[model samples]
Target: MAHTTERPVREREDASIGELLSAVTSDAQKLFRQEIELAKAEVREEATKAGKAAGMYGGAGFAGYMTALFASLAIVFALANVMDWGWAALIVTAVWAVAALVLYMMGRSRMREVSPKPERTVQTLKEDAEWARHPTR
Candidate 1:
């Protein structure tokens, strides 16, 4: 069976003002619902991307830590042949301390470059709310 997919395009032109207003209200409601659905889908898509990126960062961090541990072990063993084991351990500890200090300094510098607040997004949302309530102003 062929299903009819048509909207009533024939307007009475004589439609009462109340009828027109009712139709407008219905269409606006439908449009609002559709906008909400679209926003929800967009947020879901963005969240999925954020989750994947976070997982990738976590994996990279884990691999970096493992590499550092193994390399430290190898270095200590190699240095042990040239010096006492205690001295080799001390050298490795000193190197790690220096690396940690360097990382802390760089992290602090980068944090200074980042904004702590969502300034633009907050402003835009406030403007949208204002326009919605008082469209002309």
Candidate 2:
């Protein structure tokens, strides 16, 4: 006669495929949150770089505008001195002024194109806040 031992098999709920997939998705979400937090500094740095680039572009445009204004004035003065014709100089100066105004407006519109609003980042932050308020199980 041999002694026999009885043991009950353990039933693991997480052994099913669905349970495993859910566990993986939950862990992924947590990891995504942590990654987002880690990337905040990088995002801030990139934003600063973008802002600096925009400012440089703006300054370059303003400089070009002022240069055009002064050049037009210089042309008027030169024409007046050399040609000894006040009306011709005045007419040329007025044309230059109008051209400069048009160019300046165009430059302003171009600058507006690169302006940053941070709308996407703001929306992401809002979504993250909402998730934090009501996290998944």
Candidate 3:
């Protein structure tokens, strides 16, 4: 006995080609707008993080400045008991300068952690483009 084979058929378009084109164009425009918005939001979030880090660095700078000023007087007084007050004051000032340098470096490292690139948005946009190119998949 011979068996008949059946196959599934693709659906036909109900609208005219121009209408379809128009619809597709509208959808594409909307998609791009949404992508732009997503990029903006992502960048804004990253920028906010960067701003916070910058503010932290500024605070460190202020603190370091204040510490240096007060520490200078303390160093001079503490050194008075040592061999020569002048020598002690100089040594203490050097130590305070080194401490400030360390704090500046720490602040720099912290700020470096914050990247300006909208990495997540870039990744999503790439995926969206890939899907747009091969939507049937």
Candidate 4:
């Protein structure tokens, strides 16, 4: 005869209702904790993206200020002398303007990528709510 580990149907059915409820409660608590952890991870990732976007904006602002400063100096020097130092200063100003534009574009792109809401967590929580409503499914 083969050895068997299965409990008899009568013995299985004898499990107390309190025991079953306790097991369900324990599992629910574990699931809740896991969901919380997932949400935190998602939020952290989004926050990091937002921080990068903000930094890019700061860099763009600095570049814009430099562009303005250089352009003013270029204009003053050009009025003083139209040929040598003036042209050089104007070239430098143009370079700063280009840098400022590039930085602004990069910051805009990064800002677009950032999302304040945690999308994945929202979707999962919605699913969890549905499951809570119809757990047997």
lDDT of 3 at 130: 93
Give each prediction's root-mean-square deviation over alpha carbons.
6.4, 10.5, 8.4, 5.7
What lDDT is reached at residue 21 by model 2?
60
Ranking by TM-score: 3, 4, 1, 2
Clashing pairs in 3: none
- Per-residue C-alpha lDDT of model 1 across residues 1-137, encoded as one tens digit per residue: 98843334255476677776677577658756765665566566656655655555555556456646876789899999999999997888677666655555554554454443444445555675687688679
Model 1 has an lDDT value of 0.63
Tens-place lDDT digits, model 4, residues 72-132: 6857576556567766666766777788889888888988988777788789889988998
Better candidate number, 1 or 4, judged by TM-score: 4
lDDT of each: 0.63, 0.62, 0.76, 0.78
Cα lDDT over the full model 3 = 0.76
Candidate 2 lDDT, tens digit per residue, 16-75?
A: 676656665776698678667756755775577667656665765676577557775677
Mark the regions of model 2 whose C-alpha exceeds 4 Å error after superposition.
1-84
Candidate 4 error regions (>4 Å): 1-12, 70-80, 83-102
- For model 2, which pairs clash? none
Kindly give the number of clashing pairs for every candidate.
0, 0, 0, 0
